[model samples]
Every structure is written in structure tokens, then in C-alpha cells.
Target: MNNLPVQWMAEQSQRGRHLCLILDSTAVPGIHQALLHQLTHEHYRSVYRETAVAALSVGGPFIFSIDSLNPSSLNELLEGQTRDWGWLASIENHSIAILVKHWRERLLIGKRPQQALYRFHDNRVLARALAHLPESAYPEYLGPVISACFWQGEQWATVDNPASGEYPVPDAAQWLATPAPVNQERAILLVNVGQYLLAEHSEDLARLPEALSPRAWLIAQLDLAQRWGWQTPEQLHFLVVERLRETHTPGIKNWEPRPEEHAQAHFERLRGERFPEVKTWR
Candidate 1:
């Protein structure tokens, strides 16, 4: 079912930039081992290295320099025999290290969804980004990537970089502090992350009132947190705990903390004051 444009990929390989395959290790579990022998350029790296979500980034997204790929290896990727792969991109004159740094800074979207994992390496995200970003942003969005070959709407497609530049990677710390240039596509991706959390923690969802849909509730809570600037992992955990344990704690849905205080501290103080009932973690 994989409509990989083989001929187009071959053409893209020789365009003076290295053609690399970006694989989602979460999707294709042992991607590195699977392509070990066929790796001509061996300059492979996970896009999450040295970032805030490093612990959670295990089996994240991997990018492998693929100036040349063996025929069977290409077949393995396209046969759908394995989990879905990422994208085939032609990157400018930069090594895998350079590319990882380029994508890593973008691992989060807005400032309020602090340190939320961003799968920027995903082809779907790339496709959305192409449509979501302004023409002036193409260079920065496609930084160092000359072109990307991936599945579009219903078939194979390629998105050539509309503009080109060194388009240097930004400092991760600074990027984390500043709101990333707003992109509707990225906002959608962050909400999708919230949905993933809802599904992953479905076991704990039963504690929530039957009238409430955990998915809908969590999205609403995320909006609340964003508005409150309660965006750190600790803050997200505080809100998730409140939802799972007791659906309603004072202002848990929409409380803005003081600028001098953190969400977890505020929630702890509220829990102590209210002394509400709770369920076992199990």
C-alpha cells in the first residue's frame, strides 16, 4: 500500500544533497538494526537527542543519511511489512548531527504547552507544515532540507523547498522560552498530543465521572492550562491527577496561578485546603 515514488526518489538522491530516510522508531521498532548493513552513510541519529524530553524520546524519530539504499532495503520500507516509516528527504550540505539539531529545537510548539513532545520528524507533520506555513517561512521550516518525498493526500508526492538558506537552527533554551512562530498546523499537532495522553491513560479514566468524556475534558483542561501559562510537565501532571482522582478541585479547570508561583504548588495548596476524596492509583 506504500506508494513511494521510487523513480522520483532516485532523481532526488543525485541533486547534490544527501537523501536521507527519516523513520519513526515508535512506528518501526528496530529501524536502525533493520537497516544496519545497508547504511552507506551511517550518519544516523534520533531527532530528540539533548532535548528536554530526552527520557521520553526513546524510539522517537530517527534520521539516516541515505545517499544510496539497497534495492531490498527500499523494498522492506515500502512493502508495509514493517510499521509505517517516516519520510524520505533530500537535505542540503549538512550531516545528520546538523539535521538533528535543526529539528530538535522545534520539539515544542507554543510556550504554554511547555516541553510537550513534538514529532517534527513525522511526514504527516511535514505535510501539514507545508500547507500551514507562510511562503516566507518555507526556508526556516524546511531548514537545510532541499526537498521532501512523502505520501501526500491520497498518493505519493514531493514538496520541494520553496526557499533556501542555511536557515540556522535556533538555541533550544531560547526557543523554549519564546513562543514559536505561531503555526496552526503545530497547534493541531499539540492538541493531538493531548489526545495521545488521554488514550494512554485510559486505565485511570474510570475514576472520572461517567458523564465526562476524558478526551473532551482533557482538551478543555489543556486550553485552561494554556491560558493560565501552567505549561510545565509538573503542571500538566497536577491537572491530570486532579482529573483522574476527582474531576473537580477548585479552579482545576481554569485557575491562573500567581506569576511568582508554580502550578504544582498551587494545586498542592488547594488540595490541602479542600481535602477531597480520591481513588487508588491502581
Candidate 2:
């Protein structure tokens, strides 16, 4: 594969608000150098480290790193910190799925797409999405709305024709009042399976319960490592799950509930009523 300029990645962040930088220990040292350079140029402050061990020392509104990520390290690193920070998996392409799974769990947070963003390697698609947002949400949204995968190319193609009914903005009021639209319908649920849940059982890596199965739950435990510029990992995961749910499952109606609307909480209650098993997993 052709090596793309890491400087370009940094420059992309310069044009936006807060930047989430992911540096692979496997990458050329210049990549790290470039990151420092760009961060300085933009006068951006960050939380940073060279290893996941070091990453534990930092806090949010910052950037950090790990020497390499593995299941054990991921479990440990994820458990160490509670302050939300961006995540980067610097492993090879073949292992992307493992990282994706870890990243996948981040979808189970608040009810806004504006909460998080994820990028496999580059921010082309994510940046485009941010550009479409209203100005009021910027800067404040910088950290949560952006994410980066350590290896995406600049020439990344837009996911043209994202499946229809992928992101539906439901009326806020209806979402708060009705539980049926969520429980009665086959909507995908999001669960925060991160430190809050896993910390309870560090010795056991429990498979997320299928409590919401038949219906799906977006899990955000390991996935929120990187807070997209304005979006959170949870929001990004929701988009991905929404697409997958729309494609793989047929005959299921979709619903979007805002946090202010308390749609997710109502649904959580409904989930308990219908699938009491949810209580066990969560």
C-alpha cells in the first residue's frame, strides 16, 4: 500500500475544532513528530503518551497513545480510565475486526449523533459529517465528534448511498411519551458496556447478554477510546449499527430519540419489561 502523508491527517484537524490524534507505535517516528508539530501549530492542548501504560495518566480534552493494543491490553487500558478520551488501534489490517468489535461497544451512550465520531484511519467521511452540523455545536463538540483509524487513506471514498432510513431524527416529544414505539418495534438498543459495567467483573470478560437480542444493543465499552471532534464513539457506533440493522434485519421499523426526550431511558425501561433478561446483562 502507498504510504500517505501523516501531516495531511494533522492538517485536517487544524481546520476543525478539538483534535483526537492516534499514533501507532508501529508507525514511523515522523508520524509522532508530525502530530506534535500540528498540535503546536494549532495551539491545541492535548493528553498524550507513548504507551497505553502512559495513557492512564492523562485526562479528557487531550490525546494519548499505546505501544500496541491487544485484547489483554485493551481490557486493562479500558479499565484504567474513566475520563472519556479518543481511542486508536495501531495493529495491522487483518486485525481490524477485533478493534472494530472493541470500538463497536461505544454506541451505547446518550441519544445524539453529535456525541461521538470514529475514523478507522482518516477523517474524510467524519469531517464531511461535521461540516454539515450547525455552528452552535462546534468547538464544544470538537473532542466527541471526531475519530481516526491509524491507517485510512486520503482518497477514502464517501459511503455513497448509505442505506435508506439509516439515521431518522424522531420528534423529541413522541420519543419521551411513548415506550411502545421502542419496545413494541424492533429498534436497535445501545448499551454502555464500558468500565461502568465491566469494572464489576474484571476477572470475567462476559459476553454482552442477548437481553436486547432479536433486537440489538450498541455496546460502547471499548469503543469510545477516541472522541470524534464533536461526536462520541457511541454516536458513531449508533450510525454503524443503524445501517447494519437496516440492512441485515428486515420488517423492523426504526426510531430516533433525543437525550432531552429521554427516549433511550424509556426504551431501557421497556426493554426491562419485555426482555427482563436485560437486567442480567446490564
- What is the C-alpha lDDT profile of model 1 across 177-276, one tens digit per residue? 3234456534543554554454355556666678877666776777777766666665666666555555443434434466677665666555554445
lDDT of 1 at 255: 46
Instruction: Estimate the overall C-alpha local distance difference test score of candidate 2.
Output: 0.31
Best by lDDT: 1
Quick one: how many clashes does candidate 1 have? 0
Cα shift from native, residue 186, model 1 (Å): 13
Best by TM-score: 1
For residue 281, model 1's alpha carbon misses the true position, in angstroms, by 33
lDDT of 2 by residue, 207-260 (tens): 434354322333332222122221334434444443333444432243333356
Candidate 2: 10-residue stretch with minimal lDDT? 157-166
